[model samples]
Target: MKQPNPERTPILLGQIDTDNHIATTVSLFVILLVVHRIGISVYRLYFHPLRKFPGPRYLAATELPYLYRNHLKGDWVRDMVGLHRKYGPVVRIAPNRLALDGSIGWPQVFAHRGANQDEYAKVRGFLFPGDHEAIIAAPRDVHRRQRRQLAHAFSDGALIEHEPLICHYVSLLVQQLAKRAENNELIDIVKWLNFTTFDIIGDLTFGESFHSLDNSEYHPWVLTIFETIKGSAMGRFFAAYPIVRPLVVLSMGADRIKKLQEHQIFSKEKARARMAAGAEPGRRDFMTYMLRDTRSGEKGLTTNEIEMNSPILITAGSETTATALSGFFFYLVQTPSAYDYLTKEIRSAFRNEDEINLRSTSSLQYLQGCIEETLRCYPPSAETPPRVSPGGEIDGRYVSSGTILSVYQWSTFRNPQNFRDPDSFRPERWLPTSHPLHDVRFDNDNRSAFKPFSAGTRDCIGKKLAYSEMRLIISRILFRFDYEIAESQDDWHTSQLVFVIWDKGPLKIKLKPRTMTE
Candidate 1:
């Protein structure tokens, strides 16, 4: 009887043991994740591959320093240049990223053209309906195909054809600013710059206006887009790590995502609508120009491609021009000499508001120099543009595949090798001659090193339009007004995005109408 009881009763205990083992294993994994992240932090501080590459320890270990500087308006690029001066050009800016502030890394860095936002299946960039192409986020071949499809539009003839559209918007900007001056009201010059650029880009890309200029209140879409970008200084940190993104997406809901979806729908539908409307007797915009290119099987762009390309064009079209103008205005006001100089040039050139045409405004050399200096001093995107290596060596050292390297314009322009008084706003240095303080030879080397437009096969397609818009708007504004900063706000330095800068809050300045005559 005792033997029988022993055999029958014992088996149940084994099942409990197995379940405990599973529980123990799960506990160990959770503990490992905590340990692994800690190890990563510690190793970065000590044994990381790029440890010898100098930088502030916090930035090298993680993205926190970089993100914090952007939020704080402490100017990371400028800080980076300072660091490079202390450390060296080849500094580790983040755990997996390197900042090559000097000339060692160009051909090996940006020449490769790595994958863009579209390549990140886990994340998405702003999209529209007519195009699925990702100019800023795709493989080399994809960019080539897309750029080729749109290249003809940027020709001299095309730019000439696009002049009237440029002229019209500049006129609108001048009109609105003049009206404000007439009323003797203070306005945020930065906000108006936002309004002007977005509306013009909206009209050209989707054949619709964001109406920001007309409303004087930001369109919801414009606000959303700008907010997304505005948050990019921090957002890019979360974006790059990806470990914390799902938590964020879960927290923010799909509202902004849904709005982006709507933009794509709007882009595609507008393209279709524009095509259907056909040629009219009045005038042509970018839509009709693009329509003439495709004309065959669907002949225009497919909805997916339009969805991809439209928002990009709008982004490229709006971002740089707005930033340059904001920087232009800020510097002009900050350095009254430059402002007075520009004003004199504009006043001398134009007899009235009507005389500020696209052609008429571009004649002033000092104004152009100021615009260039503004871009150099305060570029929209100040960070190193992360690009892949071309399966080669940088400065004769071997580089592995998939290495994400970069050249930041802010840091590059500030480098002693590139400019004299690198931090100074000397527009005269941009002239054709060499400067005594700095060498200006970085403008056009065989490689795209100092590129705010990026370089090589993947340079920004909106460069021509961006220049036209910035020049036209700035010229007209200077031609029309004498502005002094509002008493309440005294600071002008603004925040930066991943590759763009958001200067939206306010540059409240009182406008005194210029006589339009010298």
Candidate 2:
């Protein structure tokens, strides 16, 4: 510093050169990466296997749009409808995914495997990221074994025995709502419906009730299940880029991961307890059938398998039934004539509250029609159930191997091609005979396109049980109380966040006890 040492000049210049070289190299590398990404995107848009399919440019080029719309915005179902409307029945939702809205694609993709036809299995991305493969999302071979064991638990005979237990819970709901009505409370009917269904499923599956209805709050495990779903929905956005998924999961922090692990541990312990104790001799629960061997003495599921499938059974059985019930009531209340008609149907059919049971409610045509219309209008699974082609043709379209094929349920159900005035609630469309308002448009609508439970081997196994729960709960509620919308919910169905299951908002309804007078 005193004299600017001449000896140090070369060293300083050399250091500067070295730093410049390093910076240049890094900049070059970044440039190459950006160039490569752009090249890939262009290829996807113009030369990829799905390039011929119609879709928005951004969605067809990269999955970022999908991630943004589905995970971040939580309105992918509505987005699907818009895409189908703009681009016709088949649209490229991703670089490799095709969403089908046409009627033929449903059976072609979801139908049972045949001798001449190729097999289509569930997409691997549907599986829970960190757990034993649950039966609902398992691969074909694993699913076959798991379904065989669990089928007995959900069998007609099993449901018959479970019916009494179901009735007991429905009775509790009726009593609870009556109390709420007496108190002049504005209740969240959706929450109560969820509590009722969850309690019944919890008792049946875990050998005890969650007591959500009794406690007037969600059980910790049920809350955990829903949080898990939200986390999962976010995780799926990264699933398209499998390489980054592990890092994304790790970044979710220790607290969330620990909570998820704790829930799994709790579920496993409960399942083990049920297996050890066995079911009551005359009255069977879910565990009883799961533990019992098939007629051929085929082995049942492993402890881990039963533990994994238990959560699925509980969530599927409870959440879906609750969604249908809440959605049905939402529409029923808005359509005063339909609501009056349905209430009359229920009240006239039941001589007393005790007389209402699954068997007795089965014959109510208007009740069934209301259920169907609700399912059509607000399906619990509003998004497409993606299927992967083993390699073959789907409705005359030759899709490349491993291409994702999905039928957008929301779009198809709402399509004018499937139902006339589809947005308007019309339960009469389900009646066997022509609706009095029928026209050529109504006659031509493809009713077969409305498959709420899906179809074939992968269809919802809990279909019959779901119907039973819906019928019993709705009838019992209508018979005991009359409800009015406590507040208006504009676009209730459209606003719901669907992440595997609907994250529903409160359906606030003011209830009044049904009075007998002319």
Candidate 3:
């Protein structure tokens, strides 16, 4: 080895010093990061505002547990049922969120806050970003205006006017099922129910039907809606962790975004066509009532508003109704006694299928009870609709402003405190006290806790239409046929994965024509 030169030795020492300095800085940064995370965990567990609340320490310490159960597992509804059971009525589901069962929670969180207090605001992130505000995502003033404008269309009078159109689709549904019955075929009742409701809503919203009933298959637009919902459910994960939004967007790929855009464009096109066609005489479609307000020079919906609300109407009006009806049959067929009782009630109430109109079905008390019980057991919209607290009292506890709160419908409906035999389906629980079928055991059941359509100013706008469709279709189907659930689909109701709405699979059933006895 050559003897070291003085100049070279200094240069080499300087290089080594620089390398050591970099390594020291990196090590210091990592240590600080770990310490900071530990500090946060300690604060969240022992000193945070929500610390007094009861929940798993892990859930209170970080949002990861809640996210894993809800976004990753897609079984938050079932998990909520279990959470309430373990933790009591109120559960600290996340670091800053509280999930309350609906008894005191619904009225407190969703009810009017009184003239002196501000109403709890809707959670903004829940609504997907869009150019125009539909009623579902509108700010309070905008929501009030939109609700006012569309009120007439969803009113009792409008439902009466729209009855014939609804009846027409129910007839088509019966006809389609009749064909399947002739062959004694196993039908996916969920798909057929979806077809009927989508066609009905498509016609009402666009002033023309989707022809799903005529084609005996799903319309392309309807399929696009399902795809959009799945994508939206995935997008929620990003919404919860905005720091990862860019990565999530990239991962969603261009195709999904393009499909969503295409769905919006199709909705806009249909709405434009309906607007161009002006109201026809005797036409009682949803557009007719909405456009009537515009023609009368009232402050009705604008063309843009109509375009924006059309898709909301399609999804909200169709999917929910179909889900409820599907749930009704799923539970009904499993409980043979309940099924037979409902069949007798419906068939005896109407002499023939032609007589099973909306009005006729409305009077079938047991039929209504069965529908109510289905809503309780398998609500169409099972997820929590979070609201930001306005520094008010909820369930007798003072909630600070900016805290997220929700009365999760699934938890509320399944809570044993809210219903006797909560896991069991008993339509008799919904019957009037004096009614012959009424069971006194359910007399103590907290009926007020059942808000399947939700409550307050923002309750479902299409509730009347949904009930009308369910009543007519269920009554007619039961009147004309007797059905049994396919053995493979015994777990249909319990085995679903919910993504915003349910990730429903086929609900297979076999139907036979009711044998007429003189």
Worst 10 residues of 2 by lDDT: 432-441
Model 1: what TM-score? Answer: 0.79
Alpha-carbon local distance difference test for all models: 0.64, 0.80, 0.83
TM per candidate comes to 0.79, 0.93, 0.93
lDDT of 1 by residue, 318-432 (tens): 8667877877887778877677777777777767767766666566677777777887777776654466543455565555454457667777777776665776777766555
Candidate 3 per-residue lDDT over residues 312-339, each given as its tens digit: 9999999989999999989998888899
Ranking according to TM-score, highest score first: 2, 3, 1
lDDT of 2: 0.80
Candidate 3 lDDT for residue 410: 79
Deviation in Å, model 1, residue 84 alpha carbon:
2.6
lDDT at 350, model 1? 68
Q: Where does candidate 2 clash, by residue pair?
A: none
Cα RMSDs, all models: 6.2, 2.5, 2.6
What lDDT is reached at residue 50 by model 3? 81
Q: What is the lDDT of candidate 3?
A: 0.83
The reply for model 2, stretches above 4 Å from the true place, is 1-3, 115-117, 125-127, 130-132, 241-259, 279-282, 434-441
